[model samples]
Target: MALDARHWVAPAWGPPEQWRLVETIVPDPGPGEVTIRVRAAGMNPADRKHVAAPRPGVSLPVPIGYEVSGEIVAIGPDTRIGSGEAEVGVEAIAFRVQGGYATALTLAAEKAFRKPAPLSHAQAANLLLAGTTAAEMLERVHARSGDTLLLHGASGAVGVMVLQLAALRGVRVIGTTSEAGSERVRRFGGIPVAYGAGLAERVRALDLPVRAALDAVGTDEAVDVSLALVADRSRIVTIAAPGRAAEHGFLSIAGSQPASAALRDGIRGELVRLADEGLLTVPLSRTYPLTDAREATRFLAREHPGGKLALIP
Candidate 1:
């Protein structure tokens, strides 16, 4: 049987205004994959950036989402769910999925995990990319118990996850944010410091021996401060400032980097475990209907909301 579904797609590279909602056929799972009826799709900056100006060689009419939470409707050969065989009607969350903006999409079975019982569809949908990114950054920096690290942009989704996960590991963090986000950073067990204008001096004034740093903000100030405070450039990793990494002699773990991919893959299951145990979470900034993806992207670009944005399909 064939399935039909509607999805938002970018037919060409341009602004958010260029995206279109179109009806399309939903394909079944192939080998090592499963088909999911998407309930919620999480949005990220990459969603907008990739659509507006897709990477070289990316095909046209590219699907516009990366993560989704849904119910499994069918399974393909060799697919397994957590060490056992997959079953239909299982609620799950998948990350790095293709065409996640659709009502239904097929995803690699290994990339799909059983949704934690306590998480709502929105939270589960929002977890994977940010959680895995946080995990990878920490791994790149070799963060551990008793260490004090500097985190730039601590109030954002990935930053919040890093703060909480670091706290769980007994690592202390000094997090940079705007005045409005300071309290949120503090609540997540980070020492909140305001960003911009002598930011390096501000972090230095704390008088703590900062062992490592992770830059989520990717500003000139963030890169400068991390370089000044952290003795070893290798221990400083930036998710945002990949292009500037070579100039500063630090490591950059942007999506395409081999180290970044390995780190993300290694920690995928651990992130689920952490969420399942209540050790981590994602704050929802807003939810929009699937039809409002354009509005959602514009809102994210303009508002720079503090938490994750999601679309309900």
Candidate 2:
């Protein structure tokens, strides 16, 4: 039997406004593949930003999502998932998958992992991108026990993950957030400082020497402040400010970088384990019906979402 699914795609290189929801046939899983009935799709800024313009090796009508949590509806022969053998009816989460903004997807089984039991579908869908990014940032700077680390954009998806992971490593985080987000930062064991004028001075007043800095926010202010406090350029890393990173001789990492990609991929299973043990979580701000992807993305662009967002298919 053939399966038809409705998924969002960028029919052309442009903004989210240009994305179209089209119905397409989902082929049966091939060797080493599985078909997932997507319950929720993780939303990330990269989903919209990456497809806004044509990049090398990309094609038109590109899929719009990178991660999803759902159930395995079908499995291919000899397929093995990240956890083990693929089987029908098992709940799973797939990252780096094609056309995740859909009711169904057939993707390589290796990309699928057993969803953590404690995580709701939304949280499972929202993990990995942020979690792995956070892990890499901390790894890049060698964040460790008793180190007082500076984190820009502390209330964001990646920043929140950094806070939690750092706490587990026994590192103390001084997280910069808006006054409105202070409680959230504190809830995750970060010392929340409002980001604005005199930010460096405020951090100095705290009297903790910032050994390493991680910038999830890409603003000039974030770059400038990170440079000011953290003495070792090698110990400062940014996900957003590559230009600043290059000019200042600091580290900048992205999924596009091969080494960073490999690091993130290696750490995925451990992150899932942390979630399974209730040591990590995704704080969700809202969820939208998959058909409302455009509206949801518009909201995400505002950059004020209190937490992660997801799409229910």
Q: Choose the strongest candidate by lDDT.
A: 2
lDDT of 2: 0.94
Best TM-score goes to which candidate?
2
lDDT of 2 by residue, 200-313 (tens): 999999999999999999999999999999999999999999999999999999988999999998999999999998999999999999999999999999869999999998
Residue pairs clashing, model 2: none
TM-score of every model versus the real structure: 0.96, 0.98
Return the number of clashes found in candidate 2: 0
lDDT of 1 by residue, 1-313 (tens): 4478888889999998999989988778888888889999999888888877758779998988999999999998777954256699999999887778879887788888888777889889999899889888898889999999999999998999999899989999999999989989999999999998888888889998899999998998899888888889989999998888988788888766676777787788888888888878888888899999999989988886878888998
What's every prediction's RMSD, in angstroms?
1.4, 0.9
Error of 2 at 11 (Å): 0.7
